[model samples]
Target: MIAEQPKTNTAASKAMAKPLKRGRACMTCRILKIKCDGVRPICGPCRKNPKEEECEFSDGPTRSRTKVLEETVSRLEARLQELEHPDETTPSVTLHDPYSPYHDSRQLSKHPSTLLMPDSRLFTPLSPFSPTSATSSLPSGRQWTSFGLEAKSDSVTSSGSSSSPHGHHASSPFLGEEEPSFGIIQNLVDNFLPHASEFGFFLNTNRFRHATLLPLPFGHHSRPSRSLLSAVYLWGAHLSQSELLLAQEHTLMIRALQHTATDIMGPHPDAVLHTLQAEVLLAYYLFQTGRFLEAKTHAATAVSLALAAGFHKIRTSNLHPQPMIGLSSETPISLHPPHDNIEEGERINGFWTVLMLHKYLTIALEPPTSVCGTLEAPGTQIDTPWPLDITNYSEGLLHPDVRGSNTIRNFLVNIPEQGYQGQSVLAMNAKAAILFHRSAQLSGQWTPNLQPREFQSFAAVFQSLNRLIETLRHSLTPLAQLDVKNPYTRTIVLTHALTDAATIKLHSIFSYSDSSSKQHCLTSARNMLAFAGFNIQDVGYLNPIIGTLWMTACHVFIDEISRLRSMHTAWPPNTEGSEDELMERLRSGMAVLNTLSDESSLGKYQLTKIQEAFSAI
Candidate 1:
């Protein structure tokens, strides 16, 4: 019937009906060019990779491995081109510390300090901010050595086979009989370098790197200071927060302080910059670890040392001089044009750092009853210029092109026409702290029996601070393109919080009712709390000043919430929505404080205060 049913065609039909098998490998395996057993939630290969959270999958048409490789190669070539032909004006690599509050997205970076030792899988031969000879001012255009390597011993044994041409013993008195091998010292120094900026110890990154790599001759007076090195280890240990490291922190800190105290009281204290740097580091460590009194005392000591070392004065000479004294203090003796820039930059930064810490301690500590009040030496002035970025000064750019290059007092006396230099985050944060201090002082001067003259003076100071705050806020890089993970974001958040805190402190005493000032205070407090909530974890307990900001915001929120409940308790139900919203915001603030309470006692204390205050209602 019909010619054998057209030969059945069963085989052809079966071939046409068969479907193509989908890929069995997990997405991570596909991307990494490795075998994977397809699994849900997490694949076998991804489980092996520590960054399992980064593994992703899709059930769609995927590009071939060859194509992916080609695209990657293309990107590499383009990046190489850019690096090779970098513009002179634009920095080849904008060096940034991941943990520092000055993180900028535009800049490339190295592995920022973390609580854990750096992951070997993530290690690279050069830092993310690796400089090219043509693009950078580095003397030799050397690539940054990877810092994640384990601290290896380079000590020679009786066999004498351990001798390497590159290895040299940079022994310190603190090391005693067991001199730290080159690798050990390097590891410790690397640990501390990233954190220095965060603590207001502005070191010249390039110079520091160069010096660390190139050993100083034996018996050289300018050998890296043992005190500074010990302090670095202490900070690094504290920051790492490992149980072993935590145990070592006390020993390291005590040793660091011991060495520093000896240096300060020793014959050549004023001639050594490390003494100032070490004292500041000790102060930062103390402050970070909840020793407010000790921090204030050490900071005061550093400030006094800085003044004696001539850090507060800018060194200018008719003829540019050479810095023959290697790694010397920035004194009149070492005042030279070319080599002075880096040292001078450190000086300015160090001075401001001390001042900033002093302000923070002044605010955080209880006055009159506490020893903090005794720490402040009357009439101490910031004569140092606002510091330029270390990179700029490192390249011998003595004066930044920006207009606002004056002493702190002069700049504050007349808020520079240039709203903010924006050239250095260190400078900007310091400025914010200075305004905060002034605002606190103005707030403190208020008394019921104040004379008219005092009232006018305080009012003027308040107005000036307010104006400066507005200008400074305007000048900050817009947050539209901010990376939430960036440290700069924290800096911006802290700046806004401090400015708002100042405003609240200024107006709250004079106007406690539902006036514009009270409303402004409430709004600022809400903003600060919102910011704290968003970035609570990233803002960590390492920063004592951040805790102060959190405490102030919590106090304001609790007070406002209490006021709202009291006011609404007597009023009709019509305003319930507004009160509910206020309650919601207060709840958010309390939640943040609770989250942070685990990190620091200040957080716990503030959280308890808020809870008690709320319970009273």
Candidate 2:
């Protein structure tokens, strides 16, 4: 009577010990077996708690589901055939090999003969002093080549390429691209697109940028040469990491193929080896997700390959910020040396393409701000440069001379010294990568006396990214918004333009670090939202991009709000605490954006997207 006995359930206990059925799905989706819907992490069920770790799914029904569905569909078709034609029938399709892109028409991505040369073209310096496109003789636009493309034909007839359309960057980046077929470029992009939605979105976002998975510019069928060349071709597009990763990945493979092709055929040695650096980044990302061994493998591979091929010279700020070396980085890298010193790095142009690569490697292996200060100041005779932001390039970053900060405003100037226009742009991209990732590390600093080193680098990177945008914009023919006439809608081209615009909206980054202090940064953010809000009143589809900016802006705004709250909490006796007004000022200023009457369709779309994203934030 005092206690009742509970019944034991052996059935459930036994089930716990039994192996759960493994599922079929893509490597990424299968890893998180929860319910792939074929897309995995991005799929509906998996997305419920993006912050939570997704379940590994490769083992059970998930793995075989695609085949099962295909089989069922085939049987239904056969039954229908029996009811109609009766005699004719075929079994369901079967995957041939164990690779992602099965049955893709283009197979030989890289051959020893064609890709022999290390990636010398990827990080050479570009001309840095060119005037902005708004003021230049030309109208700058997107260039896939800078994205690192290497198509079979330097001159594919526009008519021949009509099967796939492409958008021309506003700038005439190519030597003689009068008017490439828009359809062909679209086809190329569509076919070479790499699927990398795993990391967060947007390569340039103020969030954890290092975690972002960059998109490829091509569809699945494209070969390596196409991707390498497309890097430059896509250069003017201003794509984010996800937007550019595929092309970048393709570049590595293509360079590899080119080198391999050379060994088999002869030694063209295409001289493109920066792909090793790209792999290191991907490995770092994987490492972040808890794949340490894989990361080590890639880092080691990149280091060895880089050294073996003399590709170590390709080091730039973004791809491998710190190669694990310290101040005396001159030690020869025999095999993809992980920590080459920056001091030993060679310099070129107003830019430091290969030089920055050393920094990139160092950063990846080590932590931030510990580069032994490899970044060099210009010679005494050379004047110092000013700081810059995305939309206001000429205003802050450069001296009237523009050489002090090593900001390469134009692509041509660095060509002779670096030997590859493509390599230099990538180096710049690497620097931007560092700055972008480091910026987010800035937790809200309330009374900021001296800005944190991370913030300083962020500001510095923003300046560089702005300079790049200015250079690309200046190359366009007449400064028109991108107008790609392709079926895939050629999102990369539009996204590239949008990414740049997004960068411009990030004026919020410099808030706490400035001389005016956190107060000034808060004021600046509130002011930006007001106009940015109006920009949305102009469009809808653009709402997605706007959302990215809005969320980032909110992070800063919210930080300031919290700062005010802290001030109220810690106000000294003489220090008056009528902080409600400060709060009202910011909240009310933020309100102005929503009230903007002239919001464009793109603006509204971006705003809405951002709002949904922050539904949690």
Candidate 3:
């Protein structure tokens, strides 16, 4: 055979060399500098290197599902981090322990998997979002259900203004004081509850930024309370953004919340209630991160909190109709009309209304309205019309007293109707109007058209989001007298961040829709920063949002650096050559997305959705 074996066939020769074929390697393999069969973007070579001849596929038997999930989650987190916080100068910290003084008092806790008690306050100041009348007689309207479905419920009339349910803590601006402690739960009753320490956990900065952005007003209380030492430690560990990192951290959070909810947080009513809210918020962030099931779990927990607060056993404030999250029997929530200050009571009512609306949106089923053995039949069926309602939730911004809260109508009233800021609002409104009008024009249905008059009820919510944006814009320009870096609360700034992020998401629909009025949408988006106090054209994260949001996981990091810089008193860099920079950033982001527009990946799929969606425009 050695002397004269016929030459091997070309096919055999080719087959022998096939395993050595060179192709683009997996991102990991390329970076690791290992010999990759250059698998054609995830091929045999990529899966099992030729030299190693080792098939790494777990499909062969005995592979652990938990390990796969953990690895999958880790990869996602790393990618998200890479997309979000690219810079290292500033970072956000998560509050692992409520007592840790290292964090700001306003930001108390955010343990992703660990559930904490909701702000005890959401309970007592009972102000349900139901109509002021005992019965709403208006025609039933279309409303968006929590699951994003359209449904109608009977509208029940609300009764007269109910008195504050918490007579115990009445008349006090705030009770004497809360005891200070570290690494343990501080009980409000006669005893100290050390249980909170059981669920305490911290997240790195990259992980923290992946969570939801707090709107203004809420941000005042949220940001400071969250600045803890452990939080700082976690944040400082990683300055740059990494998608793989964010996904992994988020996985950590989900696991933590899941663990806390099942084992540590839910046995007690009060703890369960708070944990519900925390879980809900965390879930909301996960949804934003494209993690649906985890988001659903958190949302369900939040609803469960509402169910507990509305338990037939507890008394509720008539003014606040929604289920209270963490009201405790030991310390009843303080809900009372101040003899000298009706305004404060109203403010509390406003807060309750917001909470209730949140509840209504998060969980489809509304809790039965029962307060203090006062067995009133739970409010009307959702489909019933309640036009005679005393308060229009959608119009939350219009109230004159919103001076205390950042409701919608309050902010829009002062827009110099014809000026640039006003112009932005007008354009936004016009675009919105066009959206509804066009929907009506095409399908001959008014309102969101997704539902008849029901979505109209959401007009208020839309208005509120718009107001949120306006307040954020105004907040951007600190009084020339106040320190720009350390303006008090910066409630406006935070609100702007949250609302801006939200609007970007909301309008992403338009990016894909062919619009006779895209200029309006794009312009309004640009003006978002102006409303908050920046040219927007110059801001790094906010600037690129115009086009990057739909493509390249860019949505995650857009405002991270600016937020960190602002939170820490560091000056955020000014964008040089504003227009040029914006255009360039847009180009890079758009190019990545366009490349993906033809390719396949989670990030690419999302952008393609935007592109295809806008084709109608």
RMSD values for the candidates in order, in angstroms, are 25.8, 23.5, 25.9
Clashes of each: 0, 190, 91
CA-RMSD of model 3: 25.9
**Clashing residue pairs in candidate 1 (N, C-alpha, C atoms within 3 angstroms):** none
* Candidate 3 per-residue lDDT over residues 254-331, each given as its tens digit: 223433354212233224323433454454334433454555565555444434444322222123354434444564
Task: Please list the residue runs of candidate 3 whose C-alpha ends up more than 4 Å from where it truly belongs after superposition.
Answer: 1-251, 263-270, 307-494, 497-519, 529-617
lDDT per model vs. reference? 0.57, 0.33, 0.31
Top model number, TM-score:
1
Clashes of 2: 190
Per-prediction TM-score: 0.62, 0.29, 0.31
Which wins on TM-score, candidate 1 or candidate 2?
A: 1
In candidate 1, what are the lDDT values of residues 1-617, reduced to their tens digit?
55554565899668545642346555557767776655656767687766726445555367645557779999777667666777634444555565332232112223344324443223211122221122322111222221221211344333222122144332232322112345544565666665456665667765755654455432223444556655776666656644544444444555576677765433332335777778877776676555667787888887666665555554422222243332325533343242466676776677667677777777777542232322234644334456666776756555454332345656567645344343466666777777767667767767778799987877788788778766766665554445666655656666676777777766766555547777767777776776634555654333557667766766665666677667764543335336566677778778877775665445666678778877877
Tell me how far candidate 2 lies from the true structure as C-alpha RMSD in angstroms. Answer: 23.5
